[model samples]
Target chain A: MTTEAPERRGARTESPAKFRGNPWSGRVSAIAYPAVFLLLVVLLWWGATSTGMAPPYILPSPEDTWAALSENGAYLALHTWVTAVETIIGFLIAAVVGVGMAVIMVYSRTLERTFYPIILFAQVIPKIAIAPLFIVWLGFGPEPKVLVAVLMAFFPIVIAGISGLRSVDPEALELASIMGGSRWKTFIKIRFPAALPELLSGLKVAATLAVTGAVVGEFVGANEGLGYVILQANGNLDTAMLFAALIIMSALGVLLFLILEVIERISIPWHASHRNKDA
Target chain B: MMTVETPSPSTAVETDTLVDVDDITIRFDSKKSSVVALRGVSLQIQQGEFIAIVGPSGCGKSTLLRAISGITSTTEGSVSLRGDQVVGPRQDVGFVFQRPALMPWRDVRRNILLQAEMRGMDRVEARERCEDLIQFTGLTGFEKSLPHQLSGGMQQRAALCRSLLHQPDVLLMDEPFGALDALTREKMNVEMQRMWRERDMTAALVTHSVAEAVYLATRVVVMGARPGHVVEEFTVNLPRERDYEETMEDPEFHRVAGRVRELLGSASSHE
Candidate 1:
């Protein structure tokens, strides 16, 4: 009810002060918790190894894992690069295909009706089960891995984009109409921005799945990559190396997710999820 | 002076037909059933008049507004603005929805200038339009704030400014202030009253509140339930220049409010 007074001439209201960031809390989130969890896991692994609850061939000690890591660093790093390339290529393919599908689906009801059911059915079919078949068809090269990643990653983006485009508020459209806006203008200006929060949510899910889909394809047939390393390590009875590969894969996923989250925060400052009123 | 000029119908008696809603009817269809939203409804608005269309929830008040904007076309009749038939969206008509419906991504200034940007207005003009409007709505400092950042009252104020940015002759508002708290509502009512008087723009606001109808409107057009039609129209006898202090205290305002409330009550019972 109170009036909003204008700032003094040549001055403006400061952007709601960037969330009064608590660097202390960030330390807890980044260092303390991770340190504790890593310590706990290391302790558990050491205890299990020392107690001889399981044989050495099955679960190795923390030191054995470190030795394995040190011995295979060069080989693992090369294999890790292979996985990273496959993931990036596959994710890009999925993004392009998904964005194309979404654009077509948004612009044409006929396309949406024709393809929506088929895409949904494809999503329902397990991607892992399809991975070996993809490898059979496309051979042991990177093609199969990239294809599987696309299969896994495309659905969320398509669904997110469709709902984002379609779920534009009727009132906002009406406002655009009254303003003499064309359909495209309304889509670009209102629907696009409003759908950002949902679109980013779907992207996070899709991107994480992109890595998994690529690795699944790698598991079926690949001469390199983290998935290949894990498979070989398991075959050679090297549990530590397998665990290390798994850890690296998890780190990769987390890194991609954090990057996407950062982008969302920056691009959509107006989004309620990112706003800091307490600041 | 008499010998030099003659007044045209457009200039002289816009009072009869500032807005001619000619026999508009609307129907919606689904697999199971068909619903008739409006039937052969017609209305005429006048210059600088503040009219309130009061009706039940499903009485097609919003539907009628939509028809005027051509968001949904009438099965039967056409809306004409300034003697021109409104086939599609006419830039001359401004619409304010029930919800503020502000774009969450755009700040108040950018939101208000959305209409201008859509019309491809130049930057200077758009800025001027936004600045002038923000000030008019008492939202000067909220220029850089997004819709979610603003309170309900402030959001609606931004909505109002957005609607008026193009300076449309006929402003159609569908309960723009319906979602606010009572105290905020009262404050908005007072601010809106001031805006309405200053703008001298013809406005038709659809509202369920009788007190809101009484306070801001020059005429209250009472509407009935489904297959909505105007039941009665009351000409407000209050002074042209209404102050917040004198308005609530004035017995005439109370009398008008009460009568409109009774009309709304009876309309519901009849349905």
Candidate 2:
């Protein structure tokens, strides 16, 4: 009876998610579909530019953009590294500060009531509107750019972290109480782990926003970053160079998102969202 | 007048009384109004006894269990465990909730060892006990499986393992099998009876199923609705070693189940 248990259980398998064959195939298609769409879009853009349907000044040909990229590859790489550093540093700071504030708010009702409205008020102020102010206060370096990145990335992390903390099942809280675990122990063991799914989602949102914050700060004051390069190219009417910088900027955002995804998969393999990935 | 059956010597007068709930009145108060969940309820629990509190919806059966576990505070009177007043959550009490309440992040083994990890028990000893409990609970091969990977019944069984891992003196369960199907619930009832017989802890289970109350508990307390209080108590005199098939057929089981069901009928009718 014990030996047949696996076969029986396997036979009774029912998943709400559509089964799409082996994990490799599932992963391949997930990337392949988006890749195919992007390739088609590129082909259409190239065709349109070659046919002179859109003027070169208004919409530069793909070859022109690619030529500009290769010509300024070294310079672009340096700026890319700078922007990446500022965004990553800003994102890390936001994660720590936001999650810390959320923890304090969760543990103390007085703090939540006192500070949560102020946080909302701060969030309501457009981050871009304050970028010039940050440049004035902090000057034209990575400092102002990183500050803008932190500002853009902070709200979602704090909001999502608080919601995650609050989402812990009351039964689990009662269980913790019954087990006689201290309040601190319960937070570390039960409450925090329970909050991971939401917290990771918040981090992902912040990661993407971090790149925007860094670029926006650079646009306001920085002398050397992808954002600065874009501003310079735009002023010069080098649309091809502008397109190249924009492509690199988007690549940076996607890279951050993918890195967060990998971290999430490693840290929370036991989460329900990961159950459909392989056996 | 409601019936308050006199306690038989075998149950109420045991020397090693582990819990004494003395006229615990629980009231939920808001700004506008106050609602009484439990009113003047008293019960004494002996060591190694399996007591089931059965009632209709809205009765304070669950509130009583929480009061004993110190999860819910009593408005009046006190609950004493081992001769000491339970001012807050007592260390030697274990609770099993209506749902499994298993942490989605932890696998079966880690979830079972949660009790030990929280209490700062020795690491090696905790691991050994966790393995023993997994085997005992028939979750041996699935130690690495997450809660979502298991069936509802298996998840509840894992929860049972978690509650029992610490070997608390008293186990308080509020409808632990209420979410499972009938077949699984019956199997869990048999499993619970076996666990209860093997262990030395006192347990108070709040349930709505009459057959379950009669089959697993040594004594069944019937409670009424509105301002909930005890209506009647019946001592089940069935044999200790009871199987699902044979026990349900036994005349003694039928008699006790019938009486309890009839009492529940009258209690609900009054409301």
Candidate 3:
């Protein structure tokens, strides 16, 4: 069995292009399809506004939205930075606290039973409903915004962390025990690394939610941010500015998500989702 | 029928006996009911012995192996290694499961070195031993490859290398090759025999294949289910370094294999 056929073994070692599961043609289509779809959507938007089918006040032209973006580039950049900082900070906090809580709960059934239901209850309550309460408590500073982002991002991380940490193979645990590994060693060496694929997936979801959270927090009470810009634009009927702000907000979320995907690739390249098709 | 005398508890603790499972019983309890997995099961393994346990699916053979490794506790009686009572997992034994159980994030070399890391062995020595085992198992070129990159047979070989990296005094395997195809399994059994002959180690394998038990083990233990216990034992009078085809064609091998099948047939029929 070990002496595999020379050709098969050579294919695995050299990984010739012809044998790759995902060929260059497949990859080209993967990117091309999405790009073409986006182009068509933009064209449709241009047609809608250019023909007066949609009024400027209701739906701004693509050119007008672009002009608004570049004109207020500096101002929008500042607000985007503010929102970005809040989202990143909140995500970091939630990542640490959520995973820590999950580890504790997994190790102790008593804690799991005690805290799991409460967490689920907290998650079920709409976070937006409590944004106003956060404003009252933390005042209109970025603290409230960051806190709301943390709340929005916390639940998925906790849920994913719990399941990921608990998803270790029983045989692996038995092997650890036979090696005389301490609980701490087993967790650090086995449970933690094994959980990365799931945990990172949760982070991707939380990244987008973090943006929504910060924006929602700004909506209730804030002096500056993309959310504040959108509100001001709405009051002035500057539909172009409103569209620009919404675009930037989504771009920020995608940027964060892409950064996480890069981290996931670096951290666990051996994961099925990250592994090269040839490998 | 062949009859083999059961070793008494006093004799089980003799210095030459590497592992002594002294009349152990295991039971699982739940909210609704209790299931007895093993009852009054005892076996003594001498130094440098290969013992294969064969039984039906629910016969608790795997449970018995786990009990010896101290991963599962016996409800009654005790297991001792070298005159010392087995309390928790001992550091000197190695275990292989049905699946390779390699860390998906780690490459073959690092996966095998996981044992050395856990035991805090000397880094240089561990690396050298890891290299040697990789070469010995015909995984020399694939050291840098991840577990997912390897074939099922190759993965199992890597697992075997990981188990043997520490040069453990005893190796316990629970259906290690049961997942492989027939040809691959036969090839692995041959390799396993070679590895065992080269090393001065005791091994206990739990498997469902009667031919496998007869092929690889010096002593084949047949167990019965529904409160599993030993029904009979067969001693294989074959050469230590067994060739795959030669052993399969040997009359003695066929005789042992046929008897084991008969015993298993009767054992399951009783259920």
- Tens-place lDDT digits, model 3, residues B1-271: 2257344322445468889999999999999999999999988888888999998889999999988888898899999987789988777788999999999988889999999888888999999999888887788788888887787888888889888888887899999999998988887887789889987668999998888888899889888899888888877888888888888999989998998899889887887
Better TM-score candidate (2, 3) = 2
DockQ per candidate, 2 decimals: 0.39, 0.57, 0.56
Between candidates 1 and 3, the DockQ winner: 3
Q: Model 1 segments beyond 4 Å from truth? A: A1-23, A26-31, A276-279, B1-16, B251-255
Please give, for residues A164-218, the per-residue lDDT of candidate 1 as tens digits. 7777897787778778888788878987887778888888888899889889999
* Prediction 3 global C-alpha lDDT: 0.87
Please give the fraction of native interface contacts (Cα pairs under 8 Å between A and B) kept by each candidate.
0.59, 0.61, 0.61
Best by TM-score: 2
State candidate 3's DockQ: 0.56
- Weakest ten-residue segment in model 3 chain A by summed lDDT: A4-13
TM-score of chain A of each: 0.86, 0.92, 0.92
What does candidate 3's lDDT look like per residue over A94-123, in tens digits?
888888988899889999999999988878
The lDDT per prediction is 0.80, 0.88, 0.87
Q: Model 2: per-residue lDDT, tens digit, B1-271?
A: 2354546533544688889999889999999999999998988888878899999999999999989988888999999999999888777888898999999888888998999988888889888888887777778788988787787888888898899888889999999999988977887888788888776557999998999999998889998888888888888888777888998998989998999999889888887
Better of 1 and 3 by lDDT: 3
